[model samples]
Target: MTNHAAGSIPDAANTLVSENGYYGAYGGSFIPEILVPAFAEISRHFEEIRHDGDFWQRYCALLANYSGRPTPLTYADRLTAHFDRAKIYIKREDLNHTGAHKLNNALGQALLAKRMGKTRIIAETGAGQHGVATATVAAKLGLSATIYMGREDMERQYANVFWMKRLGAEVVGVDYGSQTLKDAINETLRDWVSSFETTHYVLGTASGAHPFPAIVAFFQSIIGVETKDQILQAAGRLPDRVYACVGGGSNALGVFQAFFPHDEVGLVGVEAGGQGRDSSNHAARIAYGEGKPGVAQGYRTMFLQNSDGQMKDTYSIAAGLDYVGVSPILADLSEKGRVRFAAATDAEVVEALQLVMKTEGLIPALESTHAFAGAFQDIAESSKSDIFIINMSGRGDKDIFNIAEGLQDEEWKGFIKRKNSQFEDQSR
Candidate 1:
């Protein structure tokens, strides 16, 4: 709320968070009483630095000099021709440092941690992009860092795990309870409960408890701010619709935040459909009513759960989208109809990724392919004059293993085996 997302939001969100961080009945800090004071301290420090002009200047400087800012806005002519309807534009957040938009929030939180005099940092990652971002920042800041990732995601995104360790971070693989984003989150929170005095938990995405969602969104709003300016300059007007893949909803919220004030622009969030919707395995929390209103991971939101309140296992070809719940900010948006939600099944996402790589020569992360596949669902109904801006949240460099498997490339799998054998021989 904090005036950053002050305009055109719901009446409840128009003011600073009232009722102890509830965003219109969707958000609140539900945590151990032992960690209450720790969270309060984070809230206090965040409020102070957000208002400090000097802090803003320092953060912006780091973004420009170290992380790179003002990522490109490009027209996808080949994609437009193939679709033969709306003109396709891309907000190239994929080009940022660490090859993803996650760096924006990582740098912001790392600086805040420094200002608070915390030395050690902990994080949970699914796709591995956030883990890499956190490790990179920690190395540059000379702080200790530990990253918790799901065992399944570690295999799927092995490249990211390698980079995180090379950047001097301890990567812990969580093996129980679905072995994905949710389990990693649980582990990170458990670590934070005991180490809150010396460690800062850099909640990767725009979800979780009270101040975290707000804090992550504030850092990520740079995407929306830049896109608004770039689209106006390039297209001579605002886009008809903005599309972004929604996992934990950080990238989607980052791209949708500025456009909230401009009611003319439509906001679309596409969730991962691991299989067909009928299969009961996908992560389409919004489009499908599978995730009912509930609390998990320290906040209340719509989560995929059974009647007994036990969490349901969710699946996605993209490791990042394998979470059980959507962000509280997004949950509120869905109820109010401010954002339209959709799901792109695993098959559809793979097809979309292949098509874009062929047509536009961009290898977008599997997580982002959900948005492209979702938008393509509208091509037959739209006019050619309409403009659509899709946020490519990250590149596919760190997703080589997942992408190869998604395409069912047997040769690449064989190559991986051969390479592993060669490395084993050398190490021996």
Candidate 2:
């Protein structure tokens, strides 16, 4: 976690994980033998389609026409004024359809599934945005969809579950283990072991096994492509730093791709600090030594685990960032020092969420608020001329319930109670 000497780490350009799958010994396919052929098939198809101009043409068209491409890079005037230091700009991924950058990968993967002759889609989600996005795309493509979500996450993010079901996808609640993202992932992979013939498991983030990390990063790189052009256009130069919240690392990798070639631009990834770094409940993998190198969820990476190598519990105010392990790419980057990592406590995240909403009039998702919290920490030391770009990964609409419960908003709870009572009375 300390600063490393120049030349000690691999060049960022060369460190990008490619088709071979291993990111400096961090990623590999460790799945069941039955799924090996299916993974190989996916890898081969991805390799071909990634190079096919016509395939990309179709994917890009959907991004532009359906999911809304070129999300804004808005300069935060009030936040700049408040900080009185570096300039602040937000890469407004929250403005995209489905209210997050998840849609970009969803549409791309769903298209790939169709081309591969897949008739059904199976996906796992934590905060449910990925489920909603997958469901939305499945509906558009006329494919049957099933979303696996942890019982706890589904409860906190029921709005997304509602939308997923409304989109005609089947939602299954997994109550095993922690009943959260990790459990959802476990169930989804279990389902994939048997259903890979006709179903494409749209692995939501740049985690999991070999082809998935590569596939997800490939689809997500569009965010960086847009951010690079938008930031250069808006700021007249590359930003001094790029900040993004890191859960499964798709969003951070999405924004980090364009900046990788610009070695001068610093990259920072913020992990969810559930209670505080000092407490045992948080998920600050790098900053707090909460995670160690371990294999879980089909890949080898940093995971919250015990000395016996059993997965440990993790907590985060935002369900999306509550996972036990991170993307192998992120783990490699953290080790190489190509990207520095930070932690935002649950308190800091809430405060940043309120502050951003008040200052910039933007209601960012709770997961994205962690980035704001991390970037805000640098404002005091940053030069006035310095530029910073924060990835607002999603909107806050689906997070209303989670935020209300976290804040213990009695009035909101009372309203929910009354609504439930009314519905119960009518039903009786």
Each model's TM-score, in the order given? 0.95, 0.95
Candidate 1 has its poorest 10 consecutive residues by lDDT at: 1-10
Per-residue lDDT over 1-428 for candidate 2, one digit per residue giving the tens place of the 0 to 100 score: 11111112122322466556789879887888899989988988987886677787677777777777778889999999999999999999998899999998899899999988999999999999999999999999999999999999998999999999999999999988889999998999889888999999999999998888878888888888788778777778999999999999999998998788777999999999999877888777886877899888789999989999999888999999998899899898889888999999988998898889999999999999999999998889999999999999999999998788767899999999999999999999
lDDT of each: 0.88, 0.88
Residue 14 in model 1: lDDT: 25
Q: Write the per-residue lDDT of candidate 1 for residues 1-428, one digit (tens) a residue.
A: 01222222212222435558877778899989999988999999987876677777677678777877778889999999998999999989898899999998998899988988899999999999999999999999999999999999999898899999999999999999899999999999999999989899999998999989888888888788778878888889999999999999999988998788778899999998888789988998888878899988899999989899999998999999999998889898888889999999999998999999999999999999888998999878889989999999999887787788878899999998999999999999
Candidate 2 lands at a TM-score of 0.95
Residue pairs in clash, model 1: none
Name the regions of candidate 2 deviating beyond 4 angstroms.
Answer: 1-15
Q: After superposition, how far is residue 189 of candidate 1 from its true place, in Å?
A: 0.9
